[model samples]
Target chain A: MIEALFAAVLGGLLLLGLHRKVIARVQQRPGPPVWQEVLHTLKFSFKSTWVPETASPGLFVGIVLVAIGIWTAALAVVLAGGSILIIFGVYMLHKIVEHGFGLSSGSPYGKFGAVRSVISAASEIPLFVSVAAIAVFTGSLAISDIVAYQAVNGPLLIIAPPAAFAMYLVILSKMPFSPFAIVEGKELVSGYKTEHFGVWRAGLEVANAIKTSVLLGLFLLLFLGPLSPFAFVVAIVILLVSLSFVCAVTPMLAPFDSVTIQALVTVVMLGYLVLLGVIP
Target chain B: MSSLGGAPWYILEFGDELVYFTPYTTTLLILALVFTVLALVSRPERQVEALFGTDAIYAKDTTVDQMRFRRFMAIACGCASMGAVVTGDLFNFTLFVALVGITNVGIVAAVKNRHVQNAAFQYGLVALTATVPLFAGAGIVAATTGTLSIVALASGTVPQAPFFARALLCLGVVGEGMAPFYAAKAEMFRAPGAPYVIMCSLSSLLIFLRVAEVVMVI
Candidate 1:
């Protein structure tokens, strides 16, 4: 479990670096080294962390701890092959973390970001739909059971391609430069993250990296099933490259537009689910 | 048997029926307790100053009353959420759900802003209307199965309910402010105090979770 946590944190940072490089290449500009995120984290960790006078000190600290805790729990669940329902629950609870992160600071930008976060929660419905589709196909909600089912019946992607695609979009929203990055868009001056700095910002960055790894790992587990260590790394890299490509090409959507697109995707996924007989 | 590791711990007896503690309820109870403690210790965000002008005149005694009421509502909301989770009787569960609704409204009712009050009123209307289905579902189950005991239902002593009753029960809980109805409730969170406002969301979530279990079991 600890190894999985370490791998997720480190691999996630590397993936972020790769994503930045890919975006830079797409824009025809020089980019930082692939180790840039690692250096950024190290620098932030070494700096002095302070509470903003305008913020509630307790909630400011608590939100960061909650973010780290949730991501840690999420990685542990994936590594331990626990129930997927727990993962979905954790995903939903993340809304609270975002809300707390913004509200605790009492900044207008942070509050706007928090409101966007609430609006963006509509995206999670599609994830629940995807999970339900998988549950229907596997006859269980446990990650291990789903993996075992895939071993016998082959990858669920063949059976539920649209659900997989919908999940891909959901995962895409979590990555930087995606249309759904409204919460931390340039206009909001980094949105909910505007108030956090130094060590606290470092913690948020690390937690975010772990979250990225977990989402990709979960996608792999659900769609591709468990693979050998070599195959797993290859699959993760391939998915990251695809995500980077999407991030490079797509302009960020307006907040309402992002919600509309997700809602449409969810509607289409629900139609696919109906066709697959996952939903009646 | 006194207790089993994964089995429900029988806490009370009413003739052939039993009230018991299961892992599901225990987990929610612990969560409610933790949130309750946080509410007690956390400071208010003093949102009134932000929403209204500093020159805005407000009576000091009324502000004090609002704070006191908000605290009471927060604690009540937590207790109601805990009750909704821990109670083993289906009828009692419905009662706790109703209490949660009232207290959720209470939590934000003290906010001085007209928007907050109006939102609370809208939520209160929905919550009030939702009770018909909540109690009606319970009544239907009792009528069909001859028992309102969750243990009896889970143990298969009672007959499974028709689809309508289950659907109604789910609708009632969801109407208490899940996704579709969340718009009405979201405005309530705009009220200043974070600790107390959080209780509104927490109670709704806890009750919704408990209802899923209750619907599945009964």
Candidate 2:
């Protein structure tokens, strides 16, 4: 629990710092301070909300608590010790519930956002099924069991390249960059977040910071399983460097087109893993 | 207990164990790859007709789609409901229920409209009234069984409570479910479409609860 909490907090802050620096470098400007996100969150948390008369009076305070509660719960479930099936179910529940939030609101943007969420989630089904495949081969859903399986033979990445590639796509889609950002973008005033202000908005920012750290941690766990906790950090740095290189070399693809790209990549990777005898 | 997808092709067939077949594995991998490609290729196109549809209602906000707060409420409620599934004891489930209840209350309170307000008050009353009976019955069951556990109930090891707790729990679930639906029914509700959000969230929570019950049983 401590390890997950520590990772969530520290890793989140670091990623927040890195995200800004990278954007700044891209734009060739000094950019806001690395801690700008933290400051912004703090400011929002303290600001009072002017609840619109049209808005449910109860919502004046409820949304923030709900957002924070769900995000923290998701983070905890991922980090908790359990069977893979249970954890997977928990993750699915989180995604579905997020869609529900988009719909319950009376706003059109919220409804549209929910539609995008549905499509994004549908895309995740294949990725999750692949993860389930690994569990079938390994005979356990525990993360430790998965790590042990890779360590005993070789990393699953060597045998399940297709799975790895699919996971990479999930990482991008969930983080919501260029293409998938349609659901929650600035043009939509942060989509589902439009009516929210003060503490409620801050909940989202904190949830995002924590989520990034969790994603980075998962990346390290998948690619560098044999390493110790400290070593995982080193492995992540190397992976980030590689991701940055790829990011620079590749042109951005549209979200709709990503489906075909991912499919082809999966086919090739599966063949390679099978030929290499990485998957038994 | 395990069956392949609409076919008898076995992936890992054993007396007690069920696993995926190589063919099934390959299929999953291919599907993931396809989704990735589709995600990459389908950029939102800007057609004048698509943006400004012939209909007057959705003509505005055509430039970019948005998600609504109601949908998020449904999601949060679903999450809390799922959280209830992972707990090992009745107390924990109650706590989760309370958390979900508070979340629903919060969403209902935050949104505006007489319908929402009425729904929220009704939900609040039902929820509050039910919790008391739920606790009383649970307390009686504990007194009779000498142990209070969710698993015990699932296993049929604990003495049955005064039917009141089960009824209360069911009612609470209904009230919780309605909070999102009523909010979406309102006209002023903007952003993410309401009906879709309600459907997804309600269904997800229902499944989540069933899974959690199964876990308790086993």
Candidate 3:
């Protein structure tokens, strides 16, 4: 367990550095330094938190902590080989907490962002199911078992290619790439993160970087399986390349009605049957 | 789990192959793609694209957020289903499926779109119809194929299900297919659609009841 946690933290740092470089390359401009995320976090920690007068100060402080806590918990759960069920539940809790904080801001944009966050939370269900199906096939909820299953079964992904693709889509949404980048997709002038500035803003950015890494980790576990330390590093590079390609080609999506989310999931569920012939 | 070894977790002994889940996954992936396409199609309706393409990116604000939330919820529901698939515990699978069905309805209700009320209601009714087929099919498949163990089915240890289970499953699927068009009806009514929201909530409860009936039996 300790080993897994160590790997996750180390991998997370690397992901942050990789993210900066990827952003720089995509914009065709010089970006922040690779270790910028770490420096920003340290600076934010030392600064005083400025609570908005109308905001729920108690909730405000709690919200930032909740975001950090959830991200950390996700790291822990995925590392400890906890059941996918527990991991997902914790993820949902983190999302809800973040949304609650947004709503508590009392700004119209904040409130709007909060509602949007709720919508995003709802969309995560199908993604969760796709992972669960892999667990079911692998016959273990543990992340380690998933890796082991791949080692033994020659990778369940080849057998369940459609599910893998679906998982990729889920990751895309979770990662907030273009099109599905619903929450904080610049429409609300940064969506839920709008009111935040200074240290709080930095925290939000760091948290987002953490989220991006987590999603990548999930994608690797589900599709790529167990890898040597070297392979893992290579996979990270490949993932960034793909994400950049997605960024370059696809644009962000417009916010339609929330019901469209349900329809989208239903369609995905249907596709799972048509393409994979998997009937869970 | 204990039957497979200390490595019980490593054995995917369930009768079904990994391929069984493909349909659902494909459905989600393709739908997401279709949605992106639709949004692109809608872009011409507005005036002027921005330099950052912000307008194109953040198109239908409410729908995008809601879809993201749905994906998260699906993960939870699917996790529960994994329990069912691994253990061949139809009861467990049913429970998780029910939870998802109910929650989905609740979300629709929460939206409270009047224009989509009838649609939501009809869609809810269709989902409810699946419960019966699911039960009937399971029973028939069990009787004819003479294999009652869900674990066996999942692991591919058993032959195909009997006619009944398959028939019911098909029927349930057919019923579920009718959900969408009517679902958006409530969304059309008010500025944002209140009736659809009420209906969605009502259906959530209804789905719970329906899923409960089948899952309890398994």
Q: How high is the lDDT of residue A123 in model 2?
A: 42
Which segments of candidate 2 are over 4 A away from where they belong? A2-7, A26-30, A56-66, A100-107, A176-178, A240-280, B1-196, B201-218
Over A65-123, each residue of candidate 2 has an lDDT whose tens digit, in order, gives 44454446546645652333433443444454454345434455655554454444434
Ranking by lDDT, best first? 1, 3, 2
- In TM-score terms, candidate 2 sits at 0.54
Report how far off residue B92 is in candidate 2 (Å). Answer: 26
lDDT of each: 0.76, 0.48, 0.49
Candidate 2 CAPRI level: incorrect
Query: What TM-score does structure 1 among the candidates reach?
Result: 0.85
Worst lDDT window (10 residues) for model 3 chain A? A53-62
Candidate 1 C-alpha lDDT tens digits along A1-280? 7777888899999989988998888878898899899899999999988876556566778778878887898787777676665566566666667767776766667767776776676677688668767766786666888899999989988978877887898888888887788888989888878878899989988998898899988999999986998998899989988988888888999987888878888778868767877433
Q: Which ten residues in a row have the lowest lDDT in candidate 2 chain B?
A: B40-49
Model 2 lDDT per residue over B1-218, tens place: 12111122444433322332222222222322222222122221111113354464322221222223444554565556544543435555555566666555554454444765675576566566656654554455566566555444544665654444554444454444432223332322232223322333433344334322332232
The alpha-carbon lDDT assigned to residue B150 of candidate 3 equals 45
DockQ preference between candidates 1 and 2, better one: 1
Ranking of all predicted structures according to DockQ, beginning with the best and ending with the worst: 1, 2, 3
Q: Show where candidate 1 strays beyond 4 Å.
A: A271-280, B1-33, B46-65, B82-93, B139-161, B206-218
User: Model 3 residue A237 lDDT?
Assistant: 72
